[model samples]
Target chain A: MTTAVLQERTHYLNNGYGLKSWLLTKDHKRIAVLYFITISIFFALGGVFASLIRLELVTPAGDLVSSETYNKLFTMHGVIMVFFFLIPSVPATMGNFFLPMMIGARDLAFPKINLLSWYLLIAGGGFAIFAMMAGGVDTGWTFYTPYSTTYSNTYVIATALGIFIAGFSSILTGLNFIVTVHRMRAPGMTWFKMPLFVWANYATGVIQVLGTPVIAVTLVLVFCERVFHIGIFDPALGGDPVLFQHLFWFYSHPAVYIMVLPAMGVISELVSTFSRKPIFGYPFVAFSSVAIAVIGFLVWGHHLFVSGQSLYAGLVFSFLSYFVAIPSAIKVFNWTATLYKGSISYATPMLYAFGFIGLFTIGGLTGLFVAALGIDVHVTDTYFVIAHFHYVMVGGTVMAYLGGVHYWWPKMTGRMYPEGWAKLSALFIFVGFNLTFFPQFILGYLGMPRRYHAYPPEFQVLHVASTAGATVLAVGYILPAIYLAWSLRYGPVAGSNPWGATGLEWATPSPPPTHNFDRIPVVTHEAYDYTAVPQEVEVV
Target chain B: MSSEAHAHAEETLALREQFDTAEQQKDASTLGMWIFLITEIMFFGGMFAAYTIYRSAYPTVFAVASSSLNVTIGAINTCVLLLSSFTMVMAVRAGQMGKRNMIIIFLILTLIFGCIFLGVKAYEWNEKYVEHHMPGQAAFHLEGTPLQGPAKIFFSLYFAMTGLHALHMVVGVGILLTLIVQTRAKKFSAEYFTPIDISGLYWHFVDVIWIFLFPLLYLIDRHLPK
Candidate 1:
């Protein structure tokens, strides 16, 4: 369909008006918007905390705020960003909006449950926000034992409860995705015929379903130990603190995949579509997602290596951790190979994809460094670890998230953001993100531990550099928020397939109808069969 | 059958707008429930892992604490839950048979047994409270054993596991009550009983959790001397 025909059509956005239509709607597309709005608030809140944290670290002394406030700042930052923003970032927003459309389904299999997942996130986030406003939780986002269960004078229970409730939200979304992929695929859309994005999401769903409940129960144990003195993780009452680490990271390590795998899926799409080629080694990339989810489980013990976890167990864990990297490496190599000799474009989304590849490599490599018992002992609690995850989460996940958002913006909103501004922001984020995090690797190697409000004067230069990059990153993030909103009202109307992409979602009108397709599509081509896709003339 | 008649029958099947056919709807509902149950397993699995670890650490305390639980009431509650599971199946069968009255009767029966099990659980907990076996309470005291402190751990696990199970039972009761209302409203038929089937799956899963809870919480080291 042309842009003229699309202008007269009633899409999901115009389907209903007013708050009630949105708040009570069962449509997956509406629910995704609800998630987008909610997580955006959370992202802004998390970003504020990050800015405060960076500002504090810019000096050698903790002069800006008390140590306690600083502690709460980072804690809330970690909690909100990981649980509320990053984990749900791509999956809940882009994944939710597009998964059904890609699979040629009208909506997710469980639309009510899909809506309920959004509400659960709000309710869970409400408890967390309540905790934050009501004195704030300072036990750190990990909620390690003794401090969390026995000694911390904060809202540990409220925060943990919030996360506990949100775990169900993740589980429900995962459940919806799994069932949708299994039962709602269009005719002839076999498992392999589905996009890698769906496969990655399906893998993420498996982790969410299997792993989230453990953390939910772990948080419950933390709650019981704190309130009722259950003594599961409290060492004073014959409980093992190390067990808390085991249980926490069991879900949490896989949860790292939960955060990154969906981004990898997005990267897959961005790389292939922008490169004008099919994914290289599709089965390998597809299975690597499942591989990461499974191997991701066995490596949690690596977190406990310096914590008196048995030497043999640590050895086993360290080995398994290395194994997890192989699949990740396979994906990186495959994406790079997909780009080889292919007709590559420098779209804003493709730039983000390049950023994801470069930063995720650094993140994944540092993960291996930490996975090794010898290296982990040196830098386990240092700025190196912080830099490592920020590289993955902020660098990898956030970059791909933006890339996917930009790539699919037209399909989602029927408007193309200003190309020049979009590229400028992407450049700002790329340059800014690297500047912000890379110096931390040096400071960490020089022996600066994380979560400290003050540091020696020698670390100030690196901290200042890091803080400067953060300012630029902030500007980078803010740009999209401005332009995307602007584009919604004033940007050029986007035709159905702006990128000439090869997914079912793009086959429909921009801002697809409430029923998604006029008639259910039948898949007759391989994924990213760009040869059959008529190549549009390059708009220079 | 005429195409219009078949289409009307399909509509009467109550196939949701999302599903293409009744079988697809049935499959999706059943699959969704099974996946949810897997999550439930991991939820309880976390506690069970803690239990196994702590039990191994303090076998004597766990044995003593296990003995202190009222076996008679525990056994009786087990029987009650088993009977409830039976009634739940009967309700699902009634659903499939399209016996509206039988479905309601069986659901009510199952709900009653669920309540009876909970009522017995409350009585047992009250008895423990009187006996000072309740951990974390100021009056909690276990006399004459080196395992006194660890016995608190046992009681903590006891309350945690049983309390969580009881919470599930409460939710199960709520679900059954909703099914009862829906049944009364004449929502199910021979061709459309997916909700009833999935609810039965959930109820039975709760019952199965109790089956494990019964032996692990109540019957552990019962053969040991007092």
Candidate 2:
């Protein structure tokens, strides 16, 4: 297969022309591409702030930027990365592209709403970007009240409005997925017969539907307090600031699962396909995603443990937090078991899958330590918490995201990226990620607090080490951006099933037609049925 | 299927391209609406949770502030919303029975009733404003309470919740207007009345929320005004 063949037929790309077609497109795949470009810009913007934060932290004093600037830098990094980048990272792009096709459907249930979701995210991001340009907001992404509601002089209202508007984007996507999965499955594609990725997204949809609105209303209150002096969270006006934490964490915590669940789903497919076996304990794996979402809600209280909550409440929350790890541990064990006694191939996606398993495990275990009352008291506001989430987020979700992109890049663009370069970047990410955050664990345990630009001279070595690793990680991240874009123009044309995967998505051309399929497919076999797909082996 | 047959089905049922059958499209839209309503619940639930915590914290102050509401007007608004809900049900029934004129009539009735509810709400808000009970105002005070702080908190929540519910009613009225236009345009029939049905569900859902809100916010003390 080659580039000449791509011009012969009209897929989603060639069937349409100009910005009008793309901007007005209701096609899920095109929307995914739009989301991909939009979120990538956001990622790079966040990375620039992260770089400045790292540069400032390298020395014992805040030399690169003022302490206030440092505060804005880290806050913007967390805000943009969490909301604009990670929350919509996997689900908006990959899930949007693949979930419908994987379920053997023509498109999502509501394409207009899907497009509306993208626009909402853009509108929201526009507000955040506006706030950033107009001298950045200093309130952290958490936006604890009194500081946010009473004291802060930054663009809290603009940023909070951005998040509030974007939250509807998430809710609409969730509602679309819930309706689509329930109603759009092809004739024989029963709930049990669906791909694990779809299952992963379905669970994510549940969380987005059930959890996001609380944050939306919470932001509304914050905005009201800031503008109208509503005093819902102002202690001076007979309001409890701690109640803000309760409301904020109520949605923000499960929001972690909202970011990670789709990543886990992507890994399930990657691991099973590369290992060439059905994922072991399929039912358990499927149910665990839902269990994690359900239990994820109850454990938001763990975040409030060190916030002067009741001692008994802390105990209850700590215990429930431990239960969330059970489902997570179940998923890890199941993935490991799926890899056992199988023809394992370490493709780029598989490398990311392996990295995701290791990092998410470490992230999840450290999660338990923080969930503990006494340990949370020790490390509540330290660099340890920062390192812990970076491991889960950057190490777990970002790795899985990059891996899924590599795996699907061919199918999406009708071109294969330079596999050798992809492999190199994956390795760089794996090694650089560890070097960046592992020292932060030690620094945190040694009592280095987070969000502070200046630190004691004793912490300089670890900070310097972390800074060095960040430089490496940046290179690792930039390589794919260059190579993947390069591949779109000049790389070899991809075949229908470049990876020999066995999902409905791979049954179409590399870049599928506007309607996705000439005829709707009927599923008869179980998911990850290696024997049903033709026998082939391609290692990159 | 042939293009002619497809065109005929499109003319009659207006099936969407993504759905394979008319029934599936209907089910999907209904489920989508229900899920959307669920998100709306969670949105209101956040404020309700905050209100619950505050109410428990300032029971006596909250009771006095609750009494500050005009219970008679509140009771009248409740009846108007309930009547609007009844008209919405009749509109949906007319939709099922394919009574185009009847659907239009009932939706108009629902709209008028919703407007009446909103009008009374506006008058009540004006009364609060004139009485200086609005939160954040320097002159703000409830006549029967010296605990000015908790009273402000109570008014803050009162305006927030009812204001949010009124916003939903405004949206419902907009939807009603659209439905009336569509009915006049003959876009719906007995065979396809989902837009009307789901709009009815939404109208009723708003009504139910008020049913809860009226008791919680306006009838907390339930003593007759002197």
Candidate 3:
């Protein structure tokens, strides 16, 4: 296509103007952009809270902020990061944008509902930010029992209300995905022929439908208990707090998979595309997503090992936790196999995929370490536990999110980011992330606990090391924000399928036209079949 | 199925831009409603799980607390809700018949029944308040035990469970009102009555939740006497 032709051809971006056009858009692609911007703001806010935390932990003395302030700091950080950022990171932005196109549909099963989901997230986020501005909640994101209901005087109601409202957004998005996948697949796009990204999100949609509602009700109970003295989880009124743990973790544990499963999906695409080969064990990889979703639900009890849960129940949960590892490992092994004997390119997105595999492996292995009955006792509340999750959530999900964005940046914006800077940021994030969290593993194993305001002199060295690495990681995060924004206007126009990728999304012009396809595509080829993707398309 | 679809092809409405066919759009809408209803079930299921755990832990207190409620009023409320569900089904039937006036009329009847259920619920709650059965209040007292702590747990669970159900009822009624206006505008027909059909599913779902709530809250160990 000539530059003159590309300029004259209208797309979703230029088809409308003014606030109403963007805000009232039922277009899934436009809604995805809306979500991407909203979540980016929340991610930055969460990062600021994190920087303050790392700064506070630089010395053993808690001098930077008071302990009470520290409590609110970490609590707000967790609330914002988990609910507002990581949970919506990939699925809302990338999944929403690509799932429809990947399956050869023009929009989701419900486009108006897709728009509504975005509004719900924003409304929920408004409540969260208000709570933060009103001096923040100190009950932590978990809001465990008597402390949150009977004791804490902070803004528990506001924060929980935010999360409660946000829960609906997740459910609606999931509902839209499941229905679209089932009823809206274009002609000849059979179940097996769809991309792994769709399968992963479809599994995620199942989890979201089943798991999110429980958490919504749990938050409602928390609100009722705090406001009306319901005493549901308060012990003084003969209420059992342990049951609160049961209800909370039931959704939250699966919520982890909700966060990472989409990331796993992104890695599947990155691995297949960057290697220029079909993902090895495609059936196994696809089934592994559903396997992970199913197994993810049964292991919520692992979080309750030391919370006065019975030994019998703990054993059952512990064993079930191990089963989740099998499907996750299967995905990792499959991606690695796809790499073998394939023409591999170390593109920026693939760099992030490489980082995800290594970091996610360490994260998963440490997860097994913490899942053990005996080892969990030693490190349950320690920095070891902290290290395990950050590795997965930050190292795994964030890496995959960035990779997916970079991989599809051209299609999303019709522009190419500076490749040199992109790879540089990926390297910094990988190295700096390891530097920040790896010491926590050693510190945790050595008896340094988490959520602590102060620590002993021996722990200071490691804490300082972690803080330094965090600073580096912050730089890596900021670089992309600058370059990606710059790329919007200044970067070269990225031709459709710049990297010569497969799937129906690449078949459309970059920044796909309104209604996605010029006409709904008929998908007769298997997913990731390179031959099915025309190589004649122009410049990267 | 093809012949059936073809026979009704003239009866179908204009297609949504996204879907390939009107049937596809209708199927998607129907499936979306079923999934939404299932989510509502899970939402209530959480409260039920809490109810089960606590009730088993304090069975005697739960039974004692449960028996003090007016089962007669509860039974009447249940009947009111069940009738509303039936009216909803009738409204959906009227929609399928494409009698716009009948759809509007049955929907109004269903809405009235829904309001009746809510009115009865408000009255029962006021009765509890007057009797000081409200949890965590100064004068709050259960008839049976001196501890009242376990008894308070019962009332708390009662209010929370029913409160969530009531919230859903309110939302259901709101949806019905929207459908009523759209029906008045003749926005639907025999082949395109999805909103009515979907709202019927939701209204019935809320009624079924009340069915479970009635037995679990009001009829538990009734043979033992108040």
Query: Cα lDDT for residue A258, model 2?
Result: 94
**Number of the top DockQ candidate:** 2
Q: Please give the CA lDDT of all the candidate structures.
A: 0.91, 0.92, 0.91
Per candidate, native contacts kept equal 0.76, 0.78, 0.80
In candidate 2, what are the lDDT values of residues A305-415, reduced to their tens digit? Answer: 778899999999999999999988999999999999988988889999999999999999999989999999999899999999999999999999998999899889999
Error of 3 at A279 (Å): 0.9
Candidate 1's C-alpha runs over 4 A off are: A1-7, A537-540, B1-10
List DockQ for all candidates. 0.80, 0.84, 0.80
Please give the lDDT score for candidate 3. 0.91
Clashing pairs in 2: none
CAPRI-style class, candidate 1: medium
Compute the interface RMSD for each candidate structure: 0.9, 0.7, 0.8
Candidate 3 C-alpha lDDT tens digits along A162-255: 9998999999999999999999899999999999999999999999999999999999988998788777887877888998888899999999
Give the DockQ of candidate 2.
0.84
For candidate 2, what's the RMSD? 1.2
RMSD of each: 1.7, 1.2, 2.3
lDDT of 1 at B9: 61
